[model samples]
Target: MDVEYLHHGVPLADYQLTKADRRRQDEAAQVHEWVQRQLAKAPPWSEERWERMRQLLGPPVPPWELQRWQLRLYCGHVVEATRSRERPRPDGGVCDEERCPECGMDPAVIVAFEPPANNHSPKSSRFARRPPSDRRSKAELVAENNALRAELKSLRGQA
Candidate 1:
């Protein structure tokens, strides 16, 4: 029998991986399998974890006392007017009113939430249709205009 020289602690002929290398590869495979299983598992939302998440997000706002409400659909879509029922037209035909324009579902079936804004009055949809803002009343705007005119007049007189 003839023996070949060894290079880098490995035999030149019939080269084979060492026992330590085989054990290391097996350990690496086990670690990779464990990581894959962990990734596949869903997040465990225990009561404590849920409570912590709640703490991060403040308490829910009170629902508006409006007959109509803006709804956030389960599919993450939002639409205005939730409770408005369709009415018949003068020609004795069904009105072309739709509860939800996006999903074409009735207001009752869609998941609804009060719009997260308080600028609009709860009793009326007219204000809700308008943008949410602290707009000045017509009287206030007139008063401001008059005040500005008077100031301009006074400045001109002084000049």
Candidate 2:
């Protein structure tokens, strides 16, 4: 008379045991099972830990404000085009429109023109180009710094 081991009300031979199952006979399987149990019983993320992570990551970035424009395509189809407020169109506005999908036309006329509600005023120096900067190499910068220091020392000595 043979007595079969029972697994969850089923015969142990018929029941399938995975590597991580506590019922598995192998040493590696037993270790895997212990590890899974340890993980399950592990402590959850603490508020301090969460705060530290947030500090390391810094502040969350604000979502981009998108502007939608109604455009009349050359194919007589009206469609909407969306763009971020930070981006400027060819006309220096945020009303860049895409071509008509139906007719495959390149340019489309804007149906409704609404200026972007930008929170910050446009910079006056936006179009004004700065005078070309004197490009000096690293070696030139070090030489200039040394010369300036020498001149300062000479001036102090003269005083």
lDDT: which candidate is best? 2
TM-score of each: 0.23, 0.24
Query: Candidate 1 residues 95-114, lDDT tens each?
Result: 11224567653322222244
Q: For model 2, state the Cα shift of residue 94 in Å.
A: 10
Off by over 4 Å in 2: 1-86, 90-134
Residue-by-residue lDDT tens digits, candidate 2, 19-137: 33322224433555688799899998899999999999997543334434333432346555554434443223533334568776444433323332332222222333333464677
Candidate 1 runs further than 4 Å off: 1-68, 73-77, 82-98, 106-110, 122-154
Number of the top TM-score candidate? 2
